[model samples]
Structures are given as C-alpha cells and as structure tokens.
Target: MNKRLQLFSEWLQEQHISLAFITSSPNVFYLSGFYCDPHERLLALLVFPDEEPALICPQMETARARQAGWTYEIIDYGDADNPWQLLERHMRAKNIKLDRIAVEKSHLSLERYEQLQACFQARSWLNAEEKLRQLRMIKEEKEIAILRQAAELADFAVEVGVNAIAEGKTELDIIAEIEYEMKKKGVREMSFATMVLAGENTANPHGVPGLTTIRKGDFVLFDLGVIVDGYCSDITRTVIFKSATEEQKLIYDTVLRAQLAAIEACKPGVEIGSVDRAARSIIEQAGYGPYFTHRVGHGLGIELHEYPSMNAANAMPLERGMTFTIEPGIYVPSVGGVRIEDDVFITDNGAGILTKYPKELIIVS
Candidate 1:
C-alpha cells in the first residue's frame, strides 16, 4: 500500500469513518502516484479504514496506472458500462458497509452525490478536504527534487520570453516563442495559461494576452509556469521594452522591495499571514496600497493553488518543506504594472528561492 494511503486510513480509523472517496485529480495523483485527466470520465479512489484501497478509472488507463506505480485493485469500466454499478458490486464483494463515510465535499458533484445515495445508505457525510490538504502540504525529498526541476524550467521559459521581446511584437507572439521553446525542451504541459501582458494590459493584473503590441515605454510582463513529473512552478517577471519612465521605475522598485521583504519573512514558525503583511506594508507605505491588490502569494505544488493561502487573514504558521510563491505587484491604470514573483521553500532558518532569474528591472532594448 502507498504510505500516504496508509496514513489516511489510520486517520479514518481514528475518526471512526468507514471510508473515504477521493475524486479530485490532484489528490488522486498525490495518493496513487498516477496522474490522469479523465475529463468528463469518472476517476476515483475508494479507501477504507481497515481494508485495502481500490482505484477506479477508465478501462483504457488501467495499464498506465500500473506503470505509474498502482499495485492494488483497479476497477476500470468501459464507455458503455455503468461505473456506478461496477462500484456497487465492488463494495458488495468486499462486504463494505457504508456507515459514516468521508468524501471530498468540495469536489463531489450533486449528480455523483445522488448516485452514491442509490448505492448505500450512509448515516453521515464527513469532509476529507482538510486532511487531504494536511497530507499534501508538506513536501518529501523526492517531491522537492521534482519541484526544483520544474522551477528551473520555468526560469528558462521566462528567459526565452525576455529574449524574444521587441518593440512591435504582439503579446501572443512572445507567448508562442516561449511555448515553442518549452516544447523543444521536453515540457509536456504548462501549469496554467501562459500570460504575456504588455503595456496597459499589465495594469489589469489577470489580463488576457492577445494582439496587444509592445511599445517603447511599455512594461511587458511574463507570468507562466511549467510542470515536471507532476509537480508545478509559477513565476512572473516584468521588463521594459526600450526604457522606463521615472514613475515606472519607482513602481518596479517598490514592488521588488516588497517582494524581497516578503521572501525574507519566509521562516519556519512564522505566521503565514505575516509574509503577506511584510510585502503589503512596504507597498502601502510607498503610497501604492490601493494599486497593490491581491494576496502576496499562494501555495504551489501538484496544482497551481494549494493549501495555506498567503493572505493577511490567514494565521497559519510556516513550516519546513512548505513551498509557495511570493508575488507582489503595483498596477496604476494610467501607467502600467510591475510584478516580481519567486517560488520559495521554507528552510530550517530562512527561505530557499527556487526561481532564480534576475528580478532587477531589465531593459529589453
């Protein structure tokens, strides 16, 4: 059995829960070592408190699951088959009784909940999200190794974007070159949509990349990440096309200072919220408080967003092996935007910065 599965089962037994149904792709990958996008197809892992766990996925993916280190039972179904019926039979074969069952309440759909109701009469539904988050929040040595590789690839991607910039190039043009280079380097997937916001587009923060052309005084922002061996890395860097105005320089400098201060606050035993404050306070004091929106950062790993949200209201303490991003930005509607982001890992004493591309204001001319 997978060690993570064993730990979850022990927790279930202690909670007096009979079973746990994990359906989200990230959680499934974390527990079974197999990652798949079943799309509309059903993919789930049924774990019990004292009995063995079972994996349910599309029949075509069974072999791949085995190749990915799944050694136990796999209840696979074809397109024409009713997976719910198969699941019912499997539960009967194991003599499993649904008393108090645990489930990913947030990920489970209303339709699936109804289907489960037809299968058994469970007295109560327990939420398993918090336990799952706790399990995945801490990274093991091997996981950290994969994350480091992902971060390196992300750094290279930003370098590609920076070098491809020109005065008249469209935002999509640079994005195409960056992704093409990533493909040549064997990156199978991006963690999210490749964002290459130029000029006033950067002021929108989560702006859409399109035919927006780069200009002489524009701030071109490259925010993207790549996936390596099921782990993810996210980074953002903004640079000027030919030159920066004095106001643009100040915005960039303030964001950099705030981001550095936030990274410096990433020590074990410190409140996670304090990390956000470290950056927010700096930007606020610089008179750009309203322009600097959004949280300082978010947890990064198997998924782009994970546990321990880095917001001012979260009071969770930082711990070793916890990896997240420290991104601070200031966007003025009249001017442009400046954001500096880095993937950081909490160390015994300070922080381990995974993304190492130079953050100092770079002039692309």
Candidate 2:
C-alpha cells in the first residue's frame, strides 16, 4: 500500500474501525486519487479492514478512475439499473462483513444511508466523521508540497488584486481582475468565491462584492484563494485605497500584531486552542474583542476547511506537518474592517509561514 493508505489503515486500526465507507468528494479524492464528477449519480470509496482500497464508481467514470493510477480494485457499476448490486457484489467478494460500518454522517444523505443499510445487512452502522477528519489533520509531505504550491499561486493572485485596488474601481471589477490573474497564472479555479469588500462593506465577514465603487481612505479587504493541483490556499489582506486613517491604522496594526502573535505561538505539541487564544487575546486587549467574531483560523489541505480547527473550543494538539491559516480581523460597523491572514505549516522547530505575500498594510492610490 502507498504511504497515505498505510497511514489511513493505521489510523483505522487505532480507531478500532473494521471498515469505513468514504462518501464525501474530498475524502474519496484523497484516498482513491479519483476526482468524481459532481454530476455522477453515486460514487463511493471503501476501505476494508486489511485489504487494498476499492472504488465503487459508475461505468462512465471507470476511465477517469483508471487514470488516477491507483493500485487498487475498481468496482465499476453500470449506469442502467441495479447499480447498488455492484457495491453488494464487491463487498461480498472482499468478505467485508462488519457489524459497525463507518460512514460520513455529514455528507451521506439519510436516504442513501438507508439504501446502503438495506443492501448490506450489517450488524451495525456508525458515524465515523471524526475518525476520517483525524486522519486528514496531520498532512504528509506530499500534501504539504501541494499546499505550498497553492499558497504560492494565491500570493500571486493577491498581488494582482492589491494592484487593482484603486479609487473609482468597483469591487466587482477588482474581483474580476483577481480571477483573471489566477487563470493567467495557471490556477484552474478558485477554492471559494473571491471576496472583495470596500469601506463599510468590509465589516461583513462574508460580504459580497457589489457595484460599490472603491473610494480613497476606505479599507479594502481581499479574501481569496485558488485551487492548484487539487489542494487549496486561503488568504486575506486588508489595504487602504489611499492614506490610512488613525482608526484604520490602529485596527490594521492590531490585527497584524495579533496574527503575528498567533503565528509565533504555533509549534508542534501545542494545543490548537492556544494558537487561537494567543491571537484572540491580542484583539481583546486592543478592545476589539467582539469585533473579531470568527475563529482564529482553520485547517487547510485538500479541502479549504478541514480538521484541527484553531478555535477557542477545540483542544486538538498541533503536530508537525499540520497546516492551517492564522487570520485575525477587526470589523468596525459604518467604517471598515481589517484582516491579515497567512497560511502556516507546523514544524518540529516552529511554524513556517507558507504564504510569502507582504502582510504589512498596503496603502494604494
């Protein structure tokens, strides 16, 4: 078995799970190396107790699965009817008789779960959501390389967005320029919708870019990411169109200091909560505690959001090879918001900032 599959098998052993059915698109892609078409009827990746992984896909997708170069069994189901029979046959052939089969509760629909239960008469079924998430928390070197490359592309895209931020340019125009740059730089698509908020619009954490024109002295927030090599990079930067006001400078500086403090606190063996607290404390001390509404950051790998979340409530320990974002922001209503985010990778010595873009507040004219 490959290193990733070996690691996942070991994790399953640790969790005492005999078999698991990975249904989520990201999880399926991670294990089997097959990116399923979203329009496909039903695609599943099954991991047995002590056997190679198997992919249960439609006949039309068999070619795509084969192209993944996966060294495993491909159980292709015809498109016409009785597709579920193919899954049953594969399970029977592998002799995967388990009382408690693990499934992703978040992604698997109730109807599909019922159908699965009806097809396979198992002793019991259980939700193994955390089990799979835990496996993906500490990334391997291969995953990290892809993530770093994605971050590099994101850094370039942000540079384009920053340069496009000027007086009289609409927020949508700036977003278009950023997307154009990402495409020109070889990024096939964005991880999520690019966010370009100007002035008071920045106060909304998930603000939508509209027809509002960029104005001088307004704080412009650009939260963007790109999908490169199936991995994702998320970054946020707040810049002023012209000169920064006293309040804007203070808020921007506070967020920068907080982000730096959080990044500095990241290291192997530390609790993820500490990293969040380190940044939250800075913002709270600066009297913008409530303004910093969201969590400090979240894990980033194949999916934009993953495990080992850096939040006040999470107690997962940070380990070497784990990658996440350190984003701290302060949103002031009727004025604007300031957020400075960067991707960090945990190392044996300390945290390494994967994002190379300038974190310092940029004043554009």
Q: Candidate 1: global Cα-lDDT?
A: 0.93
**Leading candidate by TM-score:** 1
Positional deviation of 301 in candidate 1, in angstroms? 0.4
68: Cα error in model 1, Å: 0.5
Model 1: how far is 281 from its true place, Å?
Answer: 0.7
TM-score of each: 0.99, 0.95
Model 2 per-residue lDDT tens digits across residues 234-346:
99988888888899989999999999999999988788888899999999999999999999999998899887788988887789988899998899999889888898998
lDDT of 1 by residue, 1-365 (tens): 87899999999999999889989999999999999999999999999998888999999999999999999899999999999999999999888788998889999999998888789889999999999999889888888889999999999999999999988899999999999999999998999999999999999889999999999999999999999999999999999999888999999999999999999999999999999999999999999999988999999999999987999999999999999999999999968898999998988999999999999999887
Candidate 2 TM-score, true structure as reference = 0.95
Error of 2 at 243 (Å): 2.0
The lDDT for every candidate, in the order shown, is 0.93, 0.85
Query: TM-score of model 1 relative to the true fold?
Result: 0.99
